[model samples]
Target chain A: MRMRFDKELEMLNGEIEKMGNLITTAIETSVKALVNQDMTLVRIVNALEMEIDEMEKTIEQHCMTLLVQQQPVASDLRLIEAALKLITDMERIGDNAEDIAEITKFFGNKTFINKLVHIPQMAEATISMVKRSVTAFVTKDKELALQVCYDDDIVDNLFLTVKNYLIDLIRQDVNNGEQAIDLLMIAKYFERIGDHAQNIAEWVIFAVTGEHMNTDNIGKTK
Target chain B: MRMRFDKELEMLNGEIEKMGNLITTAIETSVKALVNQDMTLVRIVNALEMEIDEMEKTIEQHCMTLLVQQQPVASDLRLIEAALKLITDMERIGDNAEDIAEITKFFGNKTFINKLVHIPQMAEATISMVKRSVTAFVTKDKELALQVCYDDDIVDNLFLTVKNYLIDLIRQDVNNGEQAIDLLMIAKYFERIGDHAQNIAEWVIFAVTGEHMNTDNIGKTK
Candidate 1:
């Protein structure tokens, strides 16, 4: 019975890992589409978001089933709960990615806005954070979870840089207002993605160490 | 044993209802602060957000305990799972309110760029939606849940009206850009709060009927 329970737990972990991959792909493709103005990529990101949402529901139902049938105790219970929380964040990441793609569609063939510097960097940093946080959860690595939490600072800083740069762009010419707003919104979405990633890391920590960290500042635009 | 389990379930429901009241208060105060530029109210909203977050963790722990200790089956399991999902949406409502209050702080005594019309309406609509959704969960009323889901369209429509109005404001005066963007962000937050409320209503439906509704379009701006 114990062996069977362990196998079920492993399967749950594998499922979450798969969902994490979908989230990363959404993040990567959304930003790539923005930079290259690739409509096809935008459609792919949108479709991936639907898949991610479906996966979230599937994994949630699976987690609920495990809890009902096995009545997991202690560490096992925490693992299921943590997965439950992590998937919510992962789904939000997918939503953020789709939102970015939506904003990209608004650009409407406008030429590149200020070379798209910090925005892509923010996306890259955020995607890595999502990847590492999921890995930490699967491995139960407290250290990696902590690293993901700390690494949130990088994404936060990048967001500030993007905000200031966009502000300057608008100041230089108010004619840049519409595109600048769109770009800022996109940057904010990436920052939110970073925040959801930090949330996943914190849940990972809670699952492993049973210590709840204050995450109030995780995604705040400080 | 069954009587004890039922009693415990009632207690859990009461705790969630308490949490729901806190969420409603947060929503009310945050919008009041935004319109009135009340810094004190802003502080109140922030503190309430913290309390809401704590309640989420407490309720989550309590639910997990109930599940593990009692090993509830079938309907009971579904109820607890739905509560788990509801609290998350509730907590996000708190966060969105806090975010609105945060944007209020940045406004810092600035006069309104335009008359506040749809925003306050959106707030009222969303607050009612939040209240009715929670009540629906407590009563297991599918009609109320469906009502809340339908009401989300009202909030979504108001958001679009606010967006277009703000865009026109920015277009008329370049000086209006910053405040316009801030207002837009606040409107977006309210829109998101409505989305969270719709999510709660959907969970209520799921809990009562075991039927999942497609909610991706709930709070989306058309």
Candidate 2:
């Protein structure tokens, strides 16, 4: 029975890793679509999002079945519980990526108000955070998970830079107002993606040590 | 053993309801702060958010204890699982409300911006949705839960109205650009609160009917 439970746990990890990959692809494709102004890439992001959503349902059912049949105990129970919470954050990362794509659609081939510098940087930081958070979960590497939490500062700093840059653009020329606002929203979406990644990393800590990180300070900084 | 499980389940329900009430207050106080330009209300919202966060940790511990001690089966198991999911959504509702209050702080005693009409309306609809969603979860009322899902449309339409109003304001006077973007972000936060409420109602349905709602269509509309 122990062997069977271990095998099932391995399968669960694989499924979660696959979901993480899909989320990474979605974030990357969405940002690429934005920088390139490519509608085709936008369609790809939407499709990836739908696939990610379906994977969430599948993984959830798997966890529920394992709980009912295996009746995991102690650390095993914590692992399954953390998986449930982690999937929700992963799913939101996909949603935020889709939101970015939707805003990119609105840009409609117009020249960006400024070269897309900070926004892409924010995306890179979030995507790396997402990948590392998932890896930490699969490997149960608490140090890597903590590292993911630390990486959030990079994304947050980029967000402030983007916000200030947009504010300056709006102040310099009223004509830049609409696009500046759109870009700000996109940057905000990336920042949210970072937050979700941080949440996932925190959950990993909980699963490993049975102590949830203090997330009360999450939005307080903003 | 069955009787003990039932008693613990009742406690779980009560804690969830309390968390729900905290979320409602946060939402109401945040909106009031925005409309009244009252920093005092913003402070209240912030305090309420921290309390709500503490409540989440406490309730989560309770759920973990119940699951480990009783090993509930069938419907009881479903109820506990739903509780776990519900609190996450409830916590996010509090976070979004606090976000709105934070933006209100940015307004900083500025004079009226077009009388603040639809934003207050959005707040009202979202508060109702949050309240009804929690009530449905505690009472196991599928009809009321479904009604909460339907009410999301009201919030969505109000968001579009708020968006257009802000766009027009920015068009008429470039001076309105910064405030308009800030106001737009506030409206978006309310919309997110509505989304979280809808997610809670859907989970309530999942607890009652063994079938998860198709959330695939969620961000597709936007």
Candidate 3:
């Protein structure tokens, strides 16, 4: 027989899923703000973060309430804990998105020699990780959650590429140094978002399999 | 009547307190490595992180065991859940310390002239927050935990000052742009650590008081 609190647990999951979607939107708007150099969208992402922060608080309280009232066992309990843990990652990702947007506003009509490649690639991969990780939560699929861990490697590689690109650009021409460094930091913010997404995926897998992940067990997924 | 799982919970707290000590050591070693340019110390911090990570896993499992075995109610159960959440924050603080050390290694005898008052000040405030927050946890003192929220403002002010300083430093000297920018990123990392500390304190408060802290009450801590 199902417990009465299952509906509240379901409600908690729905709220977390909504937070994930908002985070994805924030990342897209933020990265687009940078890649497309849209100051207007940058400001919008900035303003939108307060609402996300408020949502985080609300969802957190809900999770706490469920934990206290439901006294969930096994997977249900893990799901509540995972949702609680995942919110900080999502909130921090929203913050990194805002940081990237802020850095983008610094370049005023400055033309770069090349198109932004790795950054958008990084953003796309991050979005994929976020989407799939949350899906892993919704479906409780350990396999897909484990896959997101491997996906983080791609994000890490992109970070190295972006880092090297900025370093080479700065070394070649010292005059464009400021913008190049800012671009490097922007790359870092995106990479951090990927890290947070990996963290979420790890919690998803943990919720299902009772395992924790790090670089040591990169491909340890079954 | 003495509860059997209370012993398990005590062991869990012991592990958490041990991890807290490890973080204190990590913070010291990571900073020593940063200020003294000791690569060996940094490597030690990096290596010890695996142990901390494993400790988190083991403690989490222990929490799960207690929850499943005892089916604890209210405050006792809150303690276990609090331990579970505290471990994540503790581990992430370790990660942040490692990041600071890792970034410090990127510099090679390159001189930085900034007074850098804010980074260390921020670290101090954060350390205070972490200690006080955990003290609140151990003592179940809601007021002290609330004080940590107020202390977060000091760290935020330091971050803002550092940001303004970096902007002025970059605008004043084109040559100092790169190093100053790197310093800003480092400052950002420290500011984030402070944020995490504040987060831990908020958890401590919530676990005790059953009230989600109001940001409106954040500044007026008595």
Candidate 4:
């Protein structure tokens, strides 16, 4: 019975892995659409959102069934529950991508002042973090999870850079403020997506070690 | 045994209620800080964030213990699971309030093109949604839970109004861009807090009915 339960638990992980892959794909399409100004890709990402959400609900249901049928305990139970929580974060990461696509719709034919410099780099960094956060879950590597937290500092610095840069742009010309402000929001949403990815890495640590890992790193013994 | 278990669940709910109350207070303070531009309240909200993080961890630990000890089935298990998920959304909502406070710090000692009329109203709507979302769980009131979903729509419409209003502000003068962007982000954060609050309300509905509530009406149905 326990072996059967293990397969089921493993299947739960597989489903999450698949969901993570779709989210990554969604992010890719969203960025492509935004960068290339392709409304087609944005529309696809929008339509695919329902699929991603359906996958999320399916994974949550599977996790619940495991808890009920297997009565998971110790690390196993935590892992399943962590998957439940992590998937929500992962799903919202997808939502942020959709938000980006929606923002692209608002921009229409306008050119961003920076010519898409920071946003794409931010997306690249964010997708890297998303990949490693989930990889940390599959491997249960605390160091990898910790790296995810540290890498988030880079994202924060990026957010500050983009915000200050936009502020400077608007201050210099004042008339260019319209495009700059939209780009600023686009950057802000990307930064927030990175933060959610960090949240998933934290959940991976919680699952493996039975501890809550706050990004603030307070109240810990060094 | 069941009586003892019920008592344990009550303790868990009581603990969450305290955290809920803290968050409500935080929202109240953050908005005051925002409107009054009170640095002291901003710092207070920032400092209290650690306590909320600690409370989240404490609740997670307690929930795990109950899950392991009680081996709760069906409704019992679902209730604890819902609490676990609830704490997460609650914690993120707390973080959103803190983000708003942080935005207040960024505003410094300046007034802008657009007035700050809608933000306090948005904050109040989110806080009420959160308070009632948790109450829906405690009282198992599907009616109230569903009502929270409608309330989420109010915030969404408010977001649309704010977004369009800010967009027009950008188009009109464009000089107000930086300040407009800041206000827009602050508004966006409050809108997201509303989303998370709506998420809690959905969880409450799931816990009560053992089925996911429809989120189709999220920004529209109300």
Q: Pick by lDDT: which candidate is best? A: 2
Candidate 2, overall lDDT? Answer: 0.88
lDDT of 1 by residue, A1-222 (tens): 899999988998899999999999999999999999989999999999999989999999888878777888888888999998889999989999999999888775789658988998999999999999999999999889888888888887887788767767766777777788788889889888988988899899989988889765554455
Q: lDDT by residue for model 4 over B173-220, one digit each (tens)? A: 656666777788888888988888888888888888888776745558
Candidate 2 lands at a TM-score of 0.92
Candidate 3 residues lying further than 4 Å off, grouped into runs, are A3-13, A35-77, A101-117, A167-182, A215-222, B1-15, B62-83, B104-122, B153-184, B214-222
Report the Cα lDDT for candidate 1.
0.87
Best by DockQ: 1
Each model's C-alpha lDDT? 0.87, 0.88, 0.76, 0.82
- lDDT string for model 2 (A1-222, tens) is 999999999999999999999999999999999999999999999999999989998998788777767777778988998998889999999999999999999998999878999998999999999999999999999999988888788888898888778878877887787788789889999999999999999999999999878653544445
Clashing pairs in 1: none
Q: Report how far residue A210 has shifted in candidate 3, in Å.
A: 2.4
Better of 1 and 4 by lDDT: 1
In model 4, the runs with Cα more than 4 Å from the true position are A109-114, A168-178, A217-222, B110-115, B164-175, B216-222
Q: What is the TM-score of chain B alone in each candidate?
A: 0.96, 0.96, 0.90, 0.95
Q: Model 1, B146-200: lDDT tens per residue?
A: 8888888888888878877876776677778777877888888888888888889
Cα distance off (Å), candidate 4, residue B109: 3.6
lDDT of 3 by residue, A1-222 (tens): 255687787787788888888889999999888877889998989877766788888887687666655667777878877887888788888888888887778774578646899989999999999999888888888888878888887888898788667656655655555566677778888888888988988888878876665642485332
Ranking by lDDT: 2, 1, 4, 3
